[model samples]
Target: MCGKRWILDNKTLLREYIKKYRYFSLNNVVQSIGIKRCVAIKYLQLFKSEKIVFSAGRGFYTSEGREFIYPKISRVIKIRQLIIKEFPNLDFIIWNTLYFQPYYHHQQTHNITVVEVEYDGIQSVVEIISRFYRNVITESKRKLCTSEFDITNDPIIVRPFIRRSPRDGNEPRLEKMLVDIYIINYKYKIMADVDFWELWRSLFSLYRIDFSKLIDYAVGRRNMRVLISQLIDNAGLKEVIFDSKYDLLSNMTRKKGGRCRDGKTRHKTVGIIEKRNTI
Candidate 1:
């Protein structure tokens, strides 16, 4: 996952994410926060109307292409290998909308952004990773992430650039995703910095992986979805990162159950997680 900070759906904040993470799909963004589907779609449309996000697919897509669709980090690394075929001295960063001017402008955005996160050990990682594991809950982010309908009636997005000086210390939020994503009446745009594609190809040239056997690559896991992906793609690997949310969830359930081997409910592990999932 690209370490993106969330600026709730205020007029200024929504537009910034659109510009900074151009490749972000409304689905990816909202789904990360666990919003309901119809509600997600409803808001995406509104964003389109307000010109906050541009739709690439029907009722879907602020960021276009399969690259943004899946969050497989390994495959992403492989693709990075392919991209580095030419440019060598390349480094990438993840810049979210708030870093820019609060409008999802194509200009002042970044390709891959990372926020230094706290590692509270395995349990926390598992819980955060499990969002990808959800089954059958109407995935609001999946549908809403894109801009499907016409946004011609939407207002033009605007902003004034304010560069943050080194002295302006801002504390980073720890992936401030609420258990439930707040629905926006306006569509939120997912965008990638336009320059990232070029940077990707350049980065691909530096990888040690041999491209001869490379057909494509898949992200090895989901939680590292965005960050790992850019690195992988830059490696010149034929990459296609994917998520196995349900797959992981199933394994987690089986492994934990086998250890306890319990038929009865215990508030400690499985029961608690299942209850959390239900909410």
Candidate 2:
């Protein structure tokens, strides 16, 4: 076969082979197609560019090629601009809850901008932001429940940054946002268990979330075990990251019945995570 015709024919065959497995490794493709490892990797890259396949971590490729859509950051950038103009050297991260509206079942009615600045600059950052924004809170989530303060009114929360929080440029990434929201809800009861699980389910089904990155952020926040238990029991994400180092947690979960002592029943939303079909 000529080189061009051979490439075209092999590409068609590869697509057909890929359709048989929801998730497959490079070895699976090489052995099944009787191709070299280098050739299989080349083909996988072509498939990725064509939106026919996507990396699912741990050397696995998934045929479901749903791309992660970045939230609109125009408003976030405006806030960042205001902060940067004041303290050009300040190291900080800024994000808003309004970015998560599409991932929730019931639309979130309120918008809260969170500004996490370095320890040395947090007080000054808060002072600068307070001059422009009326509904600004500094370092106290306890005040969120006060009758005097209305959370529904868009609030700007200025807090000190923790070392090693995940970021995309000057804004928090999806991984960081997931961990923070989960921990906040765990501590404050801002949303019911059922509602929280539903939001996670919707997000997992629609977006390409980095499970490992999310876990790392949760670990930094000292909520790794709590978050992983919720992921396996409540969100039914065990199978999604089964190949990860968290595989041992699956056994622990079964032995413990994966129940939290809070007395509120956690409903497991399953089948949203893509299954691994035999190659």
Candidate 3:
């Protein structure tokens, strides 16, 4: 009877810990609750059975309890397959603006889909895709080209990132998509501050964001981290800021000792948090 009581107590503790963190790794649980790594794994498995936690990736677990979902842009898979069939050896990632629709409250319709490839392969890939589809354009630093497609049809844009890494699949991961959206906004300035705040709030509320992956992508862009932290504060997502894995990153972006230069410790900006429609 005493052994059963101890087991129940540990299970309660584990659930509370998961509730606090929202997302965690195996090491996090072990250190937080002073349990053996193997024991923690068993507890996580039990939690999975109860739908209290689910695996986010190889070693990541989250209490979100839902499958990761991205926007469904029409013909995205067909476009990806065409690129793979034509250039089997080249690496590329295909995504569209719609992937970000869930985060922003305002519904912004994008008529173009993006296919990111190697910088040197941009023109060649664009040429190949153009042969197969109409209204294809290549985006470059020197000039921006408008797509010929109207509101009825979707246009395709072929571009490249400043730095590219090996991706396992044709679709970009969630972290990559989030970072890329910020980069795109920097270049295009299409999204307003209100849009960004809504996006951050929705993302934290709906999914378990992997801070390590996000930070890896934002290595040179430290300001992005600071901006994200500010958005979290403005959105009143204190729980996310207090998450164990993200606490350090969130704190670093704040003014020292939580006070700004003007001696204000709280965020000044506020934005609407609502579910935006995705096309």
- lDDT winner: 2
Candidate with the larger lDDT of 1 and 3: 3
Count: clashes, candidate 1: 71
Question: After TM-score superposition, what is the CA distance of residue 11 in candidate 3 from its true location, in Å?
Answer: 1.3
Model 3, residue 173: distance off in Å is 1.9
Candidate 3 per-residue C-alpha lDDT over 1-279 given as tens digits, one digit per residue, 9 for 90 to 100: 998898778788888899887766676677778877887888999889988887654466779865347667766877878878888888788887777765568877654577888888888888888887887877775666533434335567687754533234777766666666666565555568678667766776777665545544554333354545554566544554444425544322222234567886643211011111110
Candidate 3 residue pairs that clash: none
The lDDT for every candidate, in the order shown, is 0.30, 0.67, 0.64
Instruction: Report backbone clashes per prediction.
Output: 71, 0, 0
Error of 3 at 183 (Å): 1.8
By summed lDDT, the worst window of 10 consecutive residues in model 2 runs over 270-279
**C-alpha TM-scores of all predictions:** 0.21, 0.67, 0.66
**Tens digit per residue, CA lDDT, model 1, 131-240:** 33321111121243224322222211111111221111222111111000111111332333333343334323322221111111111111222333333454232321
Ranking by TM-score: 2, 3, 1
Worst 10 residues of 3 by lDDT: 270-279
Residue 149 of model 3 has an lDDT of 32
List candidate 2 segments past 4 Å from native. Answer: 1-46, 49-51, 58-60, 70-75, 140-150, 242-245, 248-279
Clash count, candidate 2? 0
